[model samples]
Target: ETVIYRIYYYINRSGTGHLTLRELKRGNLIDAMLHCDEEEDINKVLRYFSYEHFYVIYCKFWELDTDHDFLIDKENLIRYGNHALTYRIVDRIFSQVPRKFTSKVEGNMGYEDFVYFILAEEDKSSEPSLEYWFKCIDLDGNGVLTRNEMQFFYEEQLHRMECMAQEPVLFEDILCQMIDMIKPQLVKTDYFTCLTIEISCLQDESYIMLRDLKGSKLSGSVFNILFNLNKFMAFETRDPFLIRQERENPTLTEWDRFAHREYIRLSMEDDVEDASNGSAEVWDESLEAPF
Candidate 1:
């Protein structure tokens, strides 16, 4: 309990004690963490802080398990045809998770897999997440992403960008940019140091929003579609009733912080409504037997 609060404090604004949709709309987790000098050290802190999202992730797992069969099928992921959830993103997910780890050949994901997907999406800097995506990007499973594999993902990204009628980006230029970001240091590089910097910038100063880069929609979304949705809600949505409004530090990843706050908000609303309804029921049954 104490540990969770300690983590939650750093992950959220201190005055608010947890993230609010308002603060998230202004910026993202990186903005909060970068107020400090060392991003690499902040990344390390985030890796051990997964426990901060334990509650929301558990709640969401069951929510995605539509069949009550203790698994999330492709149909579950495609729920209601939400436009932000693209087919390519969902398809790649099943293709990546090992068959042995999945619940069925039909590509159903169990709770553990769902958690891995969320962690990978929310904290690409984490070792578990970095390796999880490495497995996916390394389609051939030969321990590295070959030219063909890069082409494969890039082709889909290009197609999606074109379909959206956004200006097309020259594949060559994008490739050069990616190469530099992924392997910036030729000697003793931390490898993933800046790889995720551009790919998973969920803060308001996002690489996508800043550069307005085409196909950046799924730059990291192919790894998890919900990631994009969380960003949309955090950055685009405003507080309807002017709820709690303040800011401090950012400890949780933007997606994790967003989901956690949404869960708490909905839960509190339910409690208030339930209490009123219970009181009304008691008054109406006042004449009935207590037994």
Candidate 2:
């Protein structure tokens, strides 16, 4: 029944409280089904219909839901993406700042919630993804990300870097880079003074509004630098091969790339475990043969 309801909910995208034939056709689901037999890769289809994508998402949730209760708590979510997220961001997520949880378990995330969280995390460049993180960073829910709010999130990242013995980047330096990257319309002045002099002492009342990020492609990188250390480092020391992949397949989305990578990783882990079990069987058989 839950599965049927989920299908109905996704199919009714118009949110007019009713499902229409036009909306169903707009999904292009029939076209996809007509071509499914011709394609070898299941993930090539859109996420809504892709079993491989669902497999990857479900496996990730299963790994995090260690108790097998089919619900994720703050600790479980904290372990997500190799702990790429900070506590503050996780708190914002639980607070339902971005979106309310469909799960009524109180402070826990269900599979549906996990689905939304994973999609937003993997594809920060998308409009919905942008909105999700934007709201998370907007502490006061004022629709703009103030300097203080951004700093609130980044302070944890700075402390994390220090704890790991990595060179800590000052918030002032990051603020300058962010301003330059997004190029938010601050009073036109020599912002480069931040580079030549101590920017910490200077008062630059710059705020990053949602429109600024919506106009820039580097918005995802900005969010990563603020909260997700793994992605930030990956962006800093970006792999040439991954860059080539992106260049080669411009049609594939960030979420698509992430799901593909995770699917291969999960499959490889399963194969390794099977191989280990096979080896154990061989050793046991040899012992029985007195060799």
Candidate 3:
């Protein structure tokens, strides 16, 4: 029942309480499925059935599952992306505020849960990712992301920056930037007054609506700025090569890029480990006495 509902929810992207054939065909899913059936190699269907993507997801889980267990606890997940996510966000995830855990285990997240998390973490611009984060940030479950709620997450990020000896960006400055970028409808104010009012006052009058975030291309950056330090920094640096890649291959999702990069990194690490083991074996053989 859980799996069925999840599939239905995702397929019904329109949220009109109805799943249309048009929506199903939106991403060429049907065509991809047809090709996937025809081809002996499912990996060739990069959109959904790509083996590369599954390999990336599984590799991420394997790396985090240090005990070789099939599940990961909070500590394990914290190590993800070199601890890119803030503790507050991790807490929210463990709390299952964004989505309920399918795993029957008390505190550990299963592979399926990790897949949901990694996809959402990597691709915040997508509808499901945006929704995932919004629920996590909406700490009170009020459906709206209030200033206090946003700051609750950003506080740790600020502390992390200070601890790292980096010039910390104040929450006020970040709020201003978010307002400018998202331009969410102010509760009791207009855009003209926003410039004149103090940051503290603006907090009471401003809130981020889901639509506001969904409308912006930089929605992912908003979440990154709040909790994921590594990604947020990368966003600020604005790598021209990445920008060029996005322009060149607009069809590729953020998940695709992230998976590709991680796969290469993991493969290289495996090669290096193999080479090290081979050298160690050779050294041991040379040291062996004839008997």
Which one wins on TM-score? 3
Query: How would the candidate models be sorted by lDDT, starting from the highest?
Result: 3, 2, 1
lDDT of each: 0.47, 0.77, 0.78
Top of the candidates by lDDT? 3
| Cα error, candidate 3, residue 150 (Å) | 0.9
Cand. 1 Cα-lDDT: 0.47
Taking all chains together, each candidate's TM-score versus the true structure is 0.50, 0.79, 0.81
lDDT of 3 at 137: 94
For candidate 1, the C-alpha RMSD (Å) to the true structure equals 13.6
Clashing pairs in 1: 10-251, 11-251, 11-252
RMSD of each: 13.6, 9.3, 8.4
- Residue-level lDDT of model 1, residues 1-291, one tens digit each, is 322332332343333456667655543355444533454443233432333345456556556665556578777875522434445556767775422343554567766566556655555443334455555655546444444555565665566557878665555665555544443222223225434332223221212111221223333433332223433333334454322332333444445555556568657855887878755223233332111
lDDT of 1 at 137: 57
Enumerate clash totals for all models, in the order shown. 3, 0, 0
Residue runs of model 3 more than 4 Å from their true location after superposition: 1-28, 38-41, 186-205, 277-291
